[model samples]
Target: MPATAGERPLTPAGRRVLEVASALFYERGIGQVGMELIAAEAGVTKKTVYDRFGSKEALVLAYLRARDERWRAFLDERLAAAPSPRERVLATFDALGEWLRAESARGCSMVNAVAEVPAPDHPVHRVAAEQKSWLRGLYADLIVQAGHGDAGGLADRLALLHEGAVVMFSVGAMADAPEIARDTAAALLP
Candidate 1:
């Protein structure tokens, strides 16, 4: 009988593969990690992995999709906790700074993948761009809703700081990137 949609595997073996893939991608980057290494790490044969994800690109996309969902969820959670629209607008940078400080966190994986993928027509690049634009629009809307007279200006400024902080922290800049980001965010907030 053929396997069901969700019934790939439930034993320890399945978890091991995902755990290894996650760590490898997080550490060495997706472009550098290969299926052979993944299989070795998972104690499974290459055929098994092929059976699972079908292709390296598929695995990469799956990783990115999962990352995107988690990021959206985290931002939604933070917005829920924010007391006002102004706070919601500023939370983007504050949350970004906090996320960057994680020991295991390497900068945005989607951004990294886009940089490497290099094809504007690629689905991953399209998804990444959409995710970024969505966040920017979210901040802009929050700023407008907060009655800030210059909502577009505020959104543009915060977006620059947001992208700058990520790039700075990713490149091993000063240890105070997050603090600087928060301060900048406070200034942008109404």
Candidate 2:
């Protein structure tokens, strides 16, 4: 059983379960972490975990949602502080770089989750897809605001650059990937 859209808010105990499970899922892989471990680490019983989240799959969805929300808030803050649309676009990558260094040196959490969870129809997959869509939309909107023509096309290119930098940075193939991406973006902007 999974949580519905109208599901009631998480109880304090449920929140604890999410907190513990999110850390574990991000630190470990989704497939690697079991509900039992999450329950144990959360200081709750297995039944409580199931009772709160309904299922392991639901818990995974909750974890991804929590991560995505945090990321959006972080990126939004950085973008808000930028003086120009172009700077806002670049600030996104800057935020990503900061996030990579501070939180997830391993890689993008959504990407990691996508790699681990192969089922395309899974709720986790939808969450991952939603994150990517949101990012591309943000880039498109910013590019248009920056007075760039063919905003959609440029947005796609920028999104690729952004994702490439994350992959390169995660694999240690490019120490300056974020800066490089920003430089490439500056050239791409009209």
Candidate 3:
């Protein structure tokens, strides 16, 4: 059974488990981490972790969902603060750049999760893909609002740059990938 929305309030112990799992998954890669290690890190029994999350896949879904919520909230807040469509578009780049600069930044967790789980039937992949698609749609909407004639093309170009920069940062190629993307985006904006 899935955890109910109302039951997401974490107890101290449950919070510890989530903290450990998130860190381990981000640092070590999801495929490499085991339930036992997560339990040990959280200082809880394996059963306790199981009780809260049901299974590893479910936990992975929860982790990606949390990340999706955080990024969306940040974007929404920035759009709200900006007075014009162009400012909102630029603010999106600024927010992404800030996110990229944070130490220990593992690029978009949802994208990472999808890469880890390619099986189309996997629940984690499904949730992650849905979140990613939602992000793409939101970007396309913003571009349209900004009066871009070819919003689809603009959104595709931005998505490519954004995702490419993330992969580049993940492999340690460029620390300023986001800035590069921002520059390119600013030049492209109508």
Number of the top lDDT candidate: 2
Ranking by TM-score: 2, 3, 1
How well does each candidate superpose onto the true structure, as a TM-score?
Answer: 0.81, 0.95, 0.86
Model 1 compared with the native: what TM-score?
A: 0.81
Stretches of model 3 off by over 4 angstroms after superposition: 1-9
List RMSD in Å for every model shown. 4.0, 2.0, 2.7
Q: In candidate 1, what are the lDDT values of residues 61-109, reduced to their tens digit?
A: 6666666776778778878888988777667666676677763256777
Clashing pairs in 3: none
Rate residue 85 of model 1 by lDDT: 80
Estimate, for each residue in 51-144, the C-alpha lDDT of model 3 and write its tens digit.
8887887677766676667677877888899888877777777777777676337777777777788887888777876876776777798898
- Higher-scoring candidate on lDDT, 1 or 3: 3
What are the per-residue Cα lDDT tens digits for candidate 2 across 1-190? 1242447688888999998998999898888999899999999999999988888888888888888888889998999999998899999989988988888788888999989988898777888888899889999999989988899999999999999999999989998899999999989887
Candidate 2 deviates by what RMSD? 2.0
User: Model 2, residue 6: displacement in angstroms?
Assistant: 4.2
Q: Candidate 1 at residue 18, lDDT?
A: 62
Q: Which stretches of candidate 1 lie above 4 Å from their native place?
A: 1-19, 103-105
Number of the top TM-score candidate: 2
